[model samples]
Structure formats: C-alpha cells, structure tokens
Target: MERISFCPTLAAPLNKSEVASSRNDKSQWKTKENRPCLMVVGNDSAAAGTLKEALGEWGYDVVAARNGWEALVLAGRRPVDGMLVDMDMPIMDGRTMLSELRWLGHQMPVLIMSNESDEQVHPQLLMEGAQGFVLKPPHFQSLQQTCRKGFAK
Candidate 1:
C-alpha cells in the first residue's frame, strides 16, 4: 500500500515494523494514569506519531486509530478525555464519526482537523459536536490550548 503523507512536519514515514509495533493491543498503552487520555484518529501514521509525541510532551497519554471505525471500537472499550481527528480518512470520515460518537453518548470533546478549505464545514462540524475545528499542519500551541479548553467542558 502507498503511504499517504498529510501532516507537513513528518521527518520520515514510519517503517512497517514501527507501524506494527505501534498497533500493539491497548493493554500496552497507559491510559489509567492521572494524565488525560486522548485519542488521535488519522490515516497517516507518521503524522499521528508526531502529534502523539507532541501530546505526550504536553502531559497526555495518547491512543491512536487509523480510521473512524477503529476509533469507535477503542472508544467503546475505553474512555478518552479528548480527541483530535483528521476529517478526511479512509473507511469512515470525521464528520460521520463525530455524529456517531454523539449518538452513542461519547460526549468527549473532539477537535476536527482537515486540510479542506470549505468555509461552510466549520459550522457544520460544530453542530455535529466537535468542540473545535483545526486546520491541517496545526500549531502545537494552539492545539494544546484547544485541547485544554475542550477538557474544561
């Protein structure tokens, strides 16, 4: 499969072994700690890794999913304090996932990230239950602030 690169800060795409290691069952992830747990849903492994690292530096325990379906499964199994989701993903898109999350009563704050320039999507995402919309190649500081605000809700 061709690896799709999305986030601009990717230094190198994760090799197959790295990707497999990251996919180990949730038992290996530390989610029950005092730090907030966050779910990051994105198709690009490298980008998600970078984001996860940044979130870790900011004192969050992060879990990752490759698409919306995987995210829903993880959320059903465990709770996340917040989420950062890429709006355009294979299998299931962010908008649909947001709607499903709300319907299923997973009210955690979600921040939708997308590269699209559609001006109308922002408001629609908010209506669908996203706490905020973040443009692609997000500023880490801004994302941190947004996550903090989301956690406050």
Candidate 2:
C-alpha cells in the first residue's frame, strides 16, 4: 500500500533543530486529554485522502484503512473515538465490519458512508449499531458535521 500524508507545505523552510523542536511540541500537544481519534475506512484512495484531509483540518487524529479487515486491526490496536466506514468495500463490507466490530466488543461510535441513496439503507445501518450515515462523495462541510455528530453520540 502507498503511504499517503496530508501535511501542508510550510511557507518557509525550518532548520533541522527547529523541525525537531516542532515535532516534539506536536507530540506533546497530541497527548492532551479529550482529543478525538478518527478511523476512516474506504476502498477508494482518493476518497479516503479527501476525508483524511478534512477530518485532520478539524483537529482529529485521523487513521485511514483501505478495507474493513485493516480497519478492524487498526481499531483493535488503538483507541479510536469514532469510525467512518464506506458501505461498499472489497474483502469485507461496512455492514459486516460493523457487526464484527460490535461482536469484538468495540463500542466506539460509527458512521456509515454510501453512494446508494440513504433512503434505502441508512435506517437499517443505524439499527445495526452505526450512529449515523453520510452520503458518499460527501461535501466537506457535511462530512465534517456528520463526523462531529457521530463523536457527540
């Protein structure tokens, strides 16, 4: 898998010492209490990258998983505050993933994303343990708001 980073370019170059100091500062800041960590699971690399960028801009620690199995592994390895899962995926679909995660005793809030009309599937997904649903190809603001709502739940 290709490694993708959403870091923005700085206006000016920092010296090595400055860079190390900034990294140290960021590490300290990241440990603050109540900071949310988000897990994003999607098969589409472009969509995953866009969601990761938007959620990171909103101050969440974002982790991207290319499939459901990878998502489950990551969730088990870390303390995830919320999850954004694409309903359609290879290896495992979102519904199955949600079920399995619940079976494994993960109680973190989950939001489902789908290209299909929400009218057709959102209700059932919600019944199955997902806290909410977002339409795929999501607008930035909508996705951000939906994620915020999921975290609130």
Report the Cα RMSD per candidate: 10.1, 12.3
Across residues 34-116, which tens digit of lDDT does each residue of candidate 2 receive? 46888899999998898888888898888999988778766655667789999999877898888767755678899888887
TM-score of model 1 relative to the true fold?
0.77
Among these predictions, the greatest lDDT belongs to: 1
- Clashes found in each candidate (C-alpha, N, C closer than 3 A): 0, 0
Give lDDT tens digits, candidate 1, residues 23-112: 444465455666888999999999999999999998888999998877876776666778999999987788877876675557789989
Highest-TM-score candidate: 1
Off by over 4 Å in 2: 1-34
Off by over 4 Å in 1: 1-33
